[model samples]
Target: MVDFNVRLGLTPTDLELREIQTKRPAEFEALSADDSPELRLVEAQFAGKIVSSRLFRGEKTITVKKDKIVAIAKALRDDQETAYNYLSDLTCVDLLKVNKTEEEPRFEVIYNLYSLATFERLRLKAQVTEDDPTIDTVESVWPNANWNEREVFDMFGITFNNHSDLRRILMPDDWVGNPLRKDYPLGGEEVEFTYNVRGR
Candidate 1:
């Protein structure tokens, strides 16, 4: 005998939620750079933290590291053998109304990196704290980062350290707040009309 609410999807199983947590090639150990240095140097850098990473495969992933990002990127590019010369893209993540704890950073900054000499591709990620929400800009090493960082800051409420012009690119300059954070109330934060009112 099941209650109507239970049959109507009001309850979820623990196993179902646990299964959703483990996607392929993405686990806590997998996030560390030390874990996969033999396979990929970049992986070793993010050791034991997959919440900040999205592994696309054995070789590539997207990471969100909000601290010392510029330094880490510079080290990789000038590593002689790993000279990541290509910046494929820079993007932002918008996780609306998620269970984000203030102890952890909430925003993602994604970098698509490539080595011209070896024709290898890797992705880097850095997360920014909600209060400050800032990371060093990589425009010095990759000029393309200039525009990309600006776009992220404009739309996603990120602040790039040492960015030349960190201002709104897509939205008006006087925009009130970043509309992407998980805590942001969706659909204007309240249901305007109720199903009971329709009576259909």
Candidate 2:
């Protein structure tokens, strides 16, 4: 038997330390203070809608309320100053096991946006509670969100309101549970084998 275990050699903390050390002083300061230009713009435009923001490894992520995501998405795309015209990806994260305190919501719908002119990227996260795991669809702003949203729905059971065809893209319609959810069971069936010999 071949050993398939492989090590990356460095831990996540090491990677984070390296990122911090490699950044310029000004850039490091900006990240530390949460004062990036894009973050400032988002705060200024969507003050009340934004719940929280964080910077990690030079990447900024803004979290918004589920109900306010559509308006924020529209502004991010249509606003001249922050013309994030591209919706690179849309997905969901199940936070049931990740949030030990259970103070946060059960699901997070993530939107990866990009600007063609500025060549910048931003990640928008909207929290959805287990009781109400639904959010407004962004397919109106970017057509590509249709399939991505479907996949998220199929995997996480996070519904996207106003989606044209909100059906399972990867899993079958008869599928019982969302596979990606943390509480979902790891299911497998036992196999039986029988051997017979006629002549030895």
Candidate 3:
């Protein structure tokens, strides 16, 4: 078994430091929105659109209203200065039990983007409540989001509005529940061995 400390090429001291940092988020140095040029560009271009932004450990993440995802995505792709033309990955996170306090909008849809020419990366996020777990699709901005959005829908039940073909890409058409959900029951579905044997 690989040692946890060495697994990440980190020494024991480095692992301890990382653990401390993880536990103490307040100690994280908060950089102003203008500190990041990309963020500044976004703030200027899309005024009043950003909900929150973070620059931690050299990574940037911005949260925006769910309704404006498509517009902002298009801007990121088309904007000459912030040419984030590549959608690296699209996924969702269930924040049901992970949040310390009772945070609204139990799910967050994440979009990872990259600018090939500049080699700059950015992450965009939108929060949707469990009651209305849906967000605007970015398929118009990035055609590749078709399958990624479908997988998120299949695994988390977060619908992507205006998606051309938003169906289950991983699960069966008749699957009952979203398995990736935090509240989804463990090993709830019994294997239909009898049906398989009969068919055989």
Candidate 4:
């Protein structure tokens, strides 16, 4: 057993800190290495579908075409060698002002998958253009995607085709705009105070 003695504002000793830091790089290197079996499996399974792959800080992120997401997701979930059974999270990113140097798409729907048995994680991104911001639903592959997909749709206006019930999960059904988008209006509702109430 190990004792961390973790408490608010409590500083760890140099030896303890060094020990923790020393183990992180080795773990990261193991995951980020090109020889990982899971990585090879992913490459083999989705060869043509993969648009780009990147490794940053010991984490792998793979970008794929929006249309091929469902097939790729199904492979990741059902494959015994790469059983990414847990859908840890699903979200979208509005790349309106991001990576201006590259001609990347306007939006990207991201899926975080985890393997409870193997204790591994993978990140998959499917790019969606502003003109046609839609992707096939992964709800069939991972049922939890139902709510996560709805949240992404509500926040980024990205549609998930064949989703059981795609609707706004966080915002009102009549909300004017996707607040999370970079170009969303900054201010809208009027501030209310006791003085303002008296005037009204």
Cα lDDT tens digits, model 2, 72-182, are 888788877678999988888887755246678888899988999778888899989999888999998899999999999999998899999999999879876788886
TM values, all candidates:
0.63, 0.74, 0.80, 0.75
Q: Which TM-score value belongs to model 3?
A: 0.80
Better structure of 1 and 4 per lDDT: 4
Better of 1 and 4 by TM-score: 4
What is candidate 4's TM-score against the reference? Answer: 0.75
- Candidate order by decreasing lDDT: 3, 4, 2, 1
What does the lDDT come to for candidate 3? Answer: 0.81
- Assess each prediction's global lDDT (C-alpha) against the native: 0.66, 0.77, 0.81, 0.77
- Give the lowest summed-lDDT range of ten residues in model 2: 1-10
Q: Top TM-score: which candidate number?
A: 3
Q: Provide the lDDT at 97 for model 4.
A: 59
Off by over 4 Å in 2: 1-35, 187-200
Output the TM-score of candidate 1.
Answer: 0.63
Candidate 1 residues lying further than 4 Å off, grouped into runs, are 1-55, 62-65, 95-102, 182-200
Top lDDT hit = 3
